[model samples]
Target: MKQQLPKNFKPKALAALIGLTFTLNHASTIAQEAEPETALETITVTAQKRTQNLQEVPVSVTAFTGDEMAEAVIKDMYDLQTNVPGLGAFQSQSATNSSFSIRGVGTSSQNFGLESSVGLYVDGVYRARQNSMINNLVDVAAVEVLRGPQGTLFGKNTPSGAILVSTVTPSHDGGDSFVEATVGNYGLVNLSGATSISAIEDVLAFRVTAFGSQRDGTIDSVGNGSETGKNLLNDRNRWGARVQALYTPNDDVSVRIIADYADIDEICCGAPVQLSNATINPDGEIGSDLALPLLGGTVFAGGDAFYDREVAVSFLPESTMTDKGLSAEVDWELDENYTLVSISAYRNFESFDNIDTDFTDANLFGTYNDSKQSSFSQEIRIDYTGDNLNYILGAYYFTQDLDLDYSLYTDTFFNEFYMSSLGGALDDLFAGINAISAATGGAVAPVADAAPAGTGFDHQAKQQHESYAVFGQFDYELSDTLTLTAGLRYTDETKDLVTIFSENLADGSQSPEFFNSTTELIIGAGAAGVAAGNIGAALAGGQAPSAEDLAALLPFQTAGWGFQ
Candidate 1:
């Protein structure tokens, strides 16, 4: 089964929800002996690694307040895009991974080799990959969408831009907690709650927040009215919690620790039925030998051609995914003009095994087990606020390790029977079989052999990456309101990827069929062939191998291209 995300959400309704929730919750926080509302204290932002008025930041940034986020049901990164302009996200038609694009800069291809062009960071910890975007985040303070090139401040392959997420920290405000829930169409339900408490009078505090959501499928299966079997299978469910503790011994110094986890479970995704082009014939023939004439009555007693022409998403699975992570951040104020900050984080994400794509009724494939990926990072920064010249400096370090095990199966007989049933010895193997039946003067078409049972191919890949960067930004008050800012960063990154392929078939012996086949085609035609791998392989191969050659090869393996 295939799935598509809702492109247009109810923006007005989302805004109304956030507005109402914020009004109700904030009404309780209003102070009685309040100082005169001195021009509604402008909200300051520190996203640029420097403190400045939100409006004075020389960048295209969409800042979402906690009030706006609550009103729009913006519990996580996925929901945040609904209100931000020029930003979009979807579970690709390929995997449970989210495809994100800002101003059309994201990768459209589904290959895992290429990560997203946009960087995602939570609490100063860079989310190294895409699967982490699968679930809702808990206790978010604010989300900043920084558009355009940000490599100077954040240099993790974000050719487009980056999303900076900051979560709420524990406060000294004495209080219990509160909870909220939501119900909607498609069995949609959401529950969220949070609370804060002072552990030591004005010295120590702790806060906790959590969220969960679930929904049934909106699409229906046509073959069988089996709604139960498919409803929740294609739906989504996610939940997570965060806890934080803050300690302030004096007015100039503070320490904080925070941890969080998130998970998403939903059937994998599949592409839509868009278009189909005829497979090219190698005999210089425009169509297949089995191609049916216009009349069509002569073939198979007026029935349609034996082969059906349809556009299909080759092999997909009913997939589920889980994402979880933890991180800690600390802030220290040295005197009045100097400050320091440090953050450390770790994250893990994986996708469950299942079949989500239905290429043809004859051949189907599924994932065998969950694929896992993990990463860790640390960063430190120091800044000083000066009257004439303001400056900030920072250094970052990151590491990641990944382990993936996946499988594919071709479990139906129709495909093998259609192409390989004819025996090699005689003009027609069906002749002898029909002759025996003719002895009784009865007529019956020759029978083809039952399609061979499906074959299985599995793969394991391990990847490691390390990166470091040092950056500095300086701002000069050129005039009074006309400030000039400039920044620069130096970064180095290295990646090591190793792939292991193992084949499982009727023979029981393991071979590197899948890897050999794909790599051969990719490396054969040089860069030109590699470029074609981005689109279609058969077209790149040019010379289609015989069915016999293809059958002898590993299932899901390519034949025409040579291995490097």
Candidate 2:
């Protein structure tokens, strides 16, 4: 080559060879680097009663894994709304009064007769009560929020949406444990832990999870004498524990048993009073100002009530809830493409709320409510998986018994407020009754009590609900990415309620005759009076009146008694 080389041919050939070698080396390096270390995670969900990839499900749903929830600091159902669009959840003065709404449709009524529009299911067991729906999530595997009517899959009272929660399944592989702690402002402290162990190697496993949290109240309680204190309203105190056991007798059959208990005891929910222009009376004086003397000159926070976070409550608001349940789930693989599942569960819930109805330093009125429910349910389903078609057929049975004891009472200040508002008319009436009694030689009891302190009504109610349903859904694939779906559910339900009412006097005596006569007179006056009488009767009978009843009675009572 050095002796017989064309002038430029040798140089050009050398350069082309070097360039080809460098291109080959660069392509080899890119091939090696393009190989990914990990692949994207695939999410699985059970929205259609069968495990399927999230992207494959046709329903409008949002899902979150345990790690995601922990990362977002989601502790309870109320925190779910922060991540779920068009979903709203609120815990009122008590967990028993919690509400969940989807797309602006929900049942906010605190009536036991009404069920939630948005259904809640945990580990495939339906939770019918709001009190049971607010428990802290522990050792959770996943949560799915399905929007729009889910009645076909979930049964009754799911016209709005559904929430599905799945707990971690104990593994027979090895032992794992974790503990987490959190601290924040307002004396917040949270501790949670989980432990899983293989009990019988490849055959049986067990898991335990527990959590507890406490935090100071956001609203300050001030200027309420002995009732004044920090963290007296809207505080948080709760704890829960769950135990699970899994038995895999063989590859084709498996069984899981779970038991859980949760409790919440806290002070909650007092609203600061705010006066607006509409509160001005005909005399150009703020309506609330008329009761300033009765309230002992106590002033709620001025300006924005929420920003101020100050309330003048004579009694500390109290809310307590307890929930416990046991469930057993069995899965049997019928064949390569079919599976059978059976679930049986029993649950109990109890809650109590003592609230300052007047929301003022003055002990005018208050409420005490104690509620309990026990429920049992059983479900069986068969799932079939086919290349071009999938379907689920299920039958469900559920029954529950509910009992409630409720009361309303007022103190001396209530009578005083009424008397002053009526310009001493109550005093005059009492005097007239005394004179009549004196003339009758005590034959007529001198309206002795004059609706004294602790005078109100007690209501007791019992309700039983039973339901049976058969539901089925199917998905048929028409193409690789397009599918047709259809579902149907038929339900038969029966409900029974028994309510008893009784009135209480200052001396704690029943006055059914007096109450009935007074209620009749009030009913004759107008619709408002009729509603108040009914509410009063409900209270006297020891029944928990609905919020609507209370709201209707509040204005009527306030206007008639001259104090709110």
Candidate 3:
């Protein structure tokens, strides 16, 4: 007979007998009339650079432990808004375009030169860019959201608020591990795991953690192309990993190091156009009457009659991001009442987005952005604790380099539509000129060919930024229930940006006739001492020329309409 492993076995209850004996022996000594006492658990937070009871901190702050976050299924920065009051978070076409607001104060612009008013810090190291702030939370120990201005304590840009994230540290006594998996609708799958080990008993330890999630798109893409009949909008595909190490050779000093990386590649972010009661033409026709024909008879589906979660596109939208960073923190106890700390970090982030600007299958226009940023920062602080006084002093230095290459382009369908419109407008212009010539007895010129097709431009921008600050905060206890708190910060910053624009056409061809006709009309009218308004009235029949129209015409006079 083959040997078989035991499938089910019960061990003897040895602990129960031991417990019974101990209880019998201690029954006479124990007091049966005493009632157990209970008290609320105290929560400790580090919002002021030192640990303190949450109820004792004077700042307007909210904190959540890792267990609370896991119980609530908080996975990333976007999920914090649902649980935190007076906080708003939104991700636009990509992670790089994310926005975070605290009490209705935040930065929403996507300009490469701007910084967020609400600062984000992980392990006491600043995450200067929006892309760096959207990574999945892995092995998080605690999160603290501080409302109102925190410029003195956090430094950099924190005029609105600040978010602080602390990751679990590697412990000398290890043997910690866990694995979790979750599944949901729309083919969603999430998996994460973490493990810790001690390499040198009391001197060194290390921990490794990883997480990933993916879900199918919620919106449908319906078009006459290969992408038709596919759920290709608003999908999720991302993964990340982190490694941490701790070292404490003696009782007075400790060091922690962390390295992390994350990636996101997904087809995302387009909304259906609602045409109900929408106007698109000067004659006040409904938007669908003018837009549906242009979309080649594409119809909306999946929800209401006029509004739904369906998008029609000739090209699918795409967004991808890569974020990686390394940080080191050191803490040393100088004496019984003073401690010194230092944090140094370096990060690199890159994101690319291809979006359909027109939100239709007409292929009118599209935008592409390729951006990269590299940053380095250093902070040093010293803490002083006395019987009735506590204070912290710190200095921070940061530098970054950013590069953006942007392009806007049109296709054949857009070129054809533009040429047709340009031809009709030219016809009307020549008719007015002919009538003027008949009245003035001057020569009438024939209309010219429409301007060159497939017009587009490309530009590359580079920015360098550097900043440094010295900040300090102090608190003094005046009595048992009263305290005085004061803080100050002085910061200096500088930035430099340079942009280079490419020629309109790759072949560098010129449309001289197109420029000549338009420029001649404007210059001839101007040379005759006619006012700009009169020139506009004579050419357009009544309306004054808009600033944009005049700007477009002014460049053609000398530069010949070439983007330089």
Candidate 4:
């Protein structure tokens, strides 16, 4: 309305209208502000020692939360392959150790002088042995699989990668506890129980966890269909517990102690069944024995005589393992920006008479060998860490003393017995030849040589090794998005190898030298005894056999009886 009202009337009416407008707009603004927040949540992880967004960490890492572990059925590092890419695990049937490969770089050698490319650590304490590293890994807060050379911050010999396992620490508030049980295929059963007690309110606390698992075997014996052998190639019954006590007298100072023990009785069985046996061809001609044959006894047609049979056997023993250890550490906050920490640990592990790897041929015509090993390890380290630039300066001293014994049981008796038996049969043929020669009016040949006698090879070797290593690693962040890592280690390895040989000689004085010169040569020469003697004498005198010489000796030595 363009019409002007009395000044008082207009002011009163406008004021009322403005008041109504303010209330409506204020309500609408409040309604708009009350709408819920619509942004996704961000996750933080301690992959670099400091808390940072998971996606922001520059290095490649795979983190598994406790819940994720359960979902994936991951019980330990050996179960890590299901979730982690480019990683695989294999346990040794001949030793109390495991092989972990990352990008195909892990070591397959179980020698005391060698170190694994993949490093394993629990609660910051390095696990020196493979069996010990498989200790009860339950109740873990998270597991971080650090890929690439982790030599920078995690210590030495991690040229391939590293696995860091962290357990849940005790709560300062009045403690809590839980119990759970699980069962699976092949009679699998597992039980775990834990409780935390506030020993001294917020000043001190203790947490204890116990667990057990058992399962039936998965393999059925192929030879005799017997259930007597270990069924599960990797089946085991395990039980263990851990006690961790923490004391925080003040917010600035703290001390912690940890003790653990575990027993693992497993039947490890695995064999490498793939191999190639290469041999030299007899001659340069295409018709030589090296060439593939054809039928109907002709070069162009395939035949049954061309086929060869190949048989292979494996020799490995079942293995069992046990482990126990104790450790402690102290953390002192020197200031908000600086802190110092000291860590000390002690460990003892013994494989006992656990593994037996004698899976070879024990027949009269084959070979058999027995092998076993025992090893002990000890280690100690000290280090430090901080902000912006996080670095660990430490000294690691490691020592291992190991012993290995082996023996070979050959069929020497059977070899000798069979050769004599075969020689008797061959001798009967010689008499027939003499009669045939007399009737035909041809010259009769003398006796043919006997075949080479039993057990062609035999020997044994034993070795002991003592080794030590001192190592360290350094990690530095150049910027907010990039990091530079470097490390080096020195290892001292020593081995004492001994070889012992034996044979069932009727008179202990018989050796390969005497046997080969007389018995072996005579029998192997067959009907060519006289010609072979001359040829052998010429060879002994350093004279080579020429084509002409071979041709001249063929009929007497190799051709007449189809003996070539």
Candidate 5:
């Protein structure tokens, strides 16, 4: 082009050639200007109440998006083990009852009356109960695992760590719908879908997501091979749905209304194979009493006595769980430097189980637990953002009403230990009576059999609790490279409880209704004709066990539990 166009050439021709050359070279220039998108993108997290790059946060956290979880095939809380380091999940008979551990530290207690060491949350809502937190995850936006103590900001003071579940919020821009179905072995059927509609363009949006799954049992439960019982020690029938509404009135205000419900019905909980009875060993070291030989005579001997798919349980069992909740969250931009947020929620949880406790096909032992709980919480917070300081301050009020109906039924079959104690008491009483008769030089009423060697009991209880707290956290950018953080919380709480305990005779040969009938076993050691004395001595000073006296024992549980 050294001899290109002459200075007097047609302006149009020169312009067209230059334009063509520019177009041909534009792509090459773009290629030189644009860098490859190969570098990993940094994740943003709100674990600290402030948006920041994941790597920049001072806490140890692992984050995953909904797409990432889908790619990894993580469908529920238990599936979190796939990526969380130092974490473990034990899939029990019921998915809701699954256990989670972090660095081998987790609460082994499954008592509904207690709180967990690890905290679980959904969209900034604390799931106080683990049973309610184990439901199938719905269209999640992201999941964050915060390792170590997060007491300053979260609802509960979780020393073990926190599992934060952030579900996808209703979008204001578009509409989309998807449905998926999966079929697998053991009759596994899973169906999931979600739909979103911008009901009023930029002003209102609604989203609904739901899932249903059912699977065959892990063990072949014989179900007592009868009419009243069901297949035991199996998987669960589970389903859940979530609905959310997003309202945006201009750019300065936003509100979200959410409601969710989950229901599960299945037989669960398989007892471990008893190696031996509880006693000193055969080497005269420890008895067999502590280790009853459960599978010593099973087909698989010398190896793991119990079969992989064979639990060998013979009984009818029932297990069911229901969880439902509703919540609302509001965000108001006070200005460019401040924002106000309010989260109000109410939730209910209940699980009922009628199970065989002896782990055998025998009808000797059984237990029924009817647990119900209702809880409500309200939180209002103000967050500040400035060049020199950032902070979050909130006032929280939380209250929960709990009702636990627990009953244990067992015949004389497994009450041998208690019966032996009863026997010893009878023997001592007989000796005392003989001694009295000889000393008084009088004839005593001759007695042959004291009473049938059987014992049982019935227990019922109720609990209530209310708690309130005011908490605040402050972070100051003292300097560009150094920051200071501090926080504090104050709480006020009250609790009320009432429990009733009664004695009843063993009910093996009697009707199932007779199991709860309290007409037989003597109350307490006083009326049992034990070593202390007989009827005469008992009536002299002993206050026999009565319904009226049980009120004093109802508040046995600790009044104030630790942080959430």
Candidate 6:
């Protein structure tokens, strides 16, 4: 599916074509009239961890240079994925969360602890999480997307593929600066630019770049005091900056250091619900539809109608994300045919999400969540190239600390769960009581009373992962048109994790009034109600349901809720 990035990602590169219309026409005419064997633009990439001609590599790789990407208006990883065949990237239920897939292989959504199927690397240093890879695409250099499993070369988490990104190095050329801005409908505003300068000519150079964009959100959040425009839900606001320093003290040695930070705040991912006549939930139970009549059912956001981009949520929406990193790379020429390389990097990222989950104007359910990932990686490698043989060997070490916590709240879950949990008991009690009223020629119903049974989730988990690997790869040219390639890696990994999950009633417990009503409803149901006795006696006898009782009564409630 070629889904256009939501309205927020629209490109403003139209200005680049301003003075090229006639020139391009002339170039096209001349090229078409020239020799059939005219040369094409050359594209170079480091997909194999070395500079190489794109056509010479056997692996399936797509390479785009920094200049080419800017010209093509590819702003970020998500935009890059849109142009690649066999690549899929989409925002998950939260703006701060996203998923990627290549060639039908993809990572599941919002599973913070699971490793990505595709690996991500910046300047040869591996990144621990994919969420940290999508933003702040600035500076220079290139990106190489290698398809299929990079089993040996990249090590773990590459069963699907790998993405290699390189930022531009300091240039010795004279400095240049420019400012560009785009304003469009729907309050779309984008501004970005860069400046590069040489402090000591060929000896040292530095660059600074920044980008920011803001636009009206996609979904309109209405009802429950939601402002029509000021507090619009699903809005987009993001900005980031990067600075780089490059040093080349001698012809055989070069070093580059990069530091960057990015932040985003937005109300994103508004999910609306639609009503259906289906009689059952996927579990084969009569489902919540069975309780719809009693609960009065959910009210659609548009008051019985669903309009385009309209969402109703009783809870406010919010999402915040931040990323920071530092990296250093050095290349040293040891001799004529040999070279040494080292890459070290550190990164920290955090995201917070507040979502209105019930998908209605009524207060029902929602969630507050946070995830943080910080990691460090170091690698050193030696390269040798010869007429018939080329090889590289490297050692890598990586470590990470991850923390995630989620709080899921449901204001109406008590009714839903209790109905599902004590369906027979409630029916037994209420049936008899209603029958008693029926004999008096009157009907009685439930009120805003009793122990509402909703249980929320409080989960906090910590995970520590450490990995080390030694790997080598070689390529041999047997003849003019024949070649051989082989690679191997020895790896060790250790991981430790702990998580805590609980669910409880909103009213705290079986309040006395709730018990009285419950007993009365049971009595109304006839036989079973009479045997249960007065509410006081049953309660005093410790007859309230226990966690074990709930386990047996509400099988679906076993999942999670409460504090960890």
lDDT tens digits, residue span 208-251, model 4: 87889877644322221112343444465788888999899999
lDDT of 5 by residue, 1-564 (tens): 011223332322111110000011110000112335985566678888767667667889988777677667777876787689976666343333455567777764345566667887887787777767666775787888888878777756477788888877787443445566766655667777776779998889998888898776544443232223222355658899999999998898999999999998876655442321113322345433332333221122322222223343435457788888999999999999999999999999888877655655433456777888898988889999988888899888878888877666653334333334355644554455455345435333322222122323455667787777877888888887778988887778777877776644443332122112223323322332442243335334554434332222221111110000
Sorted on TM-score, highest at the top, how do the candidates line up? 2, 3, 6, 1, 5, 4
TM-score of each: 0.72, 0.80, 0.79, 0.60, 0.72, 0.77
* lDDT for each residue of candidate 2 in 338-404, tens digit (9 for 90 to 100): 9999999999989899877776667677888899999999999999999999999999999999999
Error of 2 at 405 (Å): 0.7
User: lDDT at 112 for candidate 3?
Assistant: 65
Which candidate leads the pack in lDDT?
A: 2
Residue 276 CA error for candidate 5 (Å)?
12
Q: Give candidate 6 regions above 4 Å deviation.
A: 1-37, 175-177, 223-231, 272-307, 412-455, 504-531, 534-564
Please state the error at residue 118 of candidate 1 in Å: 0.9
**TM-score, structure 3 vs. true:** 0.79
What are the runs in model 1 whose C-alpha is more than 4 Å off? 1-41, 224-233, 270-317, 359-362, 367-369, 417-452, 511-564
Best-performing candidate as measured by TM-score? 2
lDDT per residue (tens digit) for residues 183-276 in model 3: 7666777787777779998889898888898877766777652286545677889999999998998899999999999999888675443331
Q: Please give the lDDT score at residue 34 for candidate 4.
A: 28
Query: Between candidates 1 and 6, which one is better according to lDDT?
Result: 6
lDDT of 6 by residue, 401-463 (tens): 999988776665445544555555555545543443354344222222233435455688999
Prediction-by-prediction clash tally: 13, 11, 0, 16, 20, 22
Clashes of 5: 20
Model 1 per-residue lDDT tens digits across residues 1-564: 223322332122211222112122321211123335775545566568665676678878887656567667676666777789977776654445567778778864234556677888877778766766657755566778888878877888778888887776677663435577767666777777788779997789988888888776533222211122333334567788888788888887777777777776664443432112122322233444242222110122111211212222323345666667777777788767788988888888776656533332224333455467788888888887888778889999988887777665444533343334323422232343334235424332233222233445667787888888998888889888788888999988888999877655545643333225445533332433222232234424554433442232222222211111
Q: All candidates' lDDT scores? A: 0.58, 0.71, 0.69, 0.51, 0.61, 0.65
Q: Distance (Å) between predicted and true CA of 84, model 4?
A: 0.7
Better model by TM-score, 1 or 6?
Answer: 6
Among residues 3 or more apart in sequence or in different chains, the pairs in candidate 3 whose N, CA or C atoms overlap within 3 Å are none
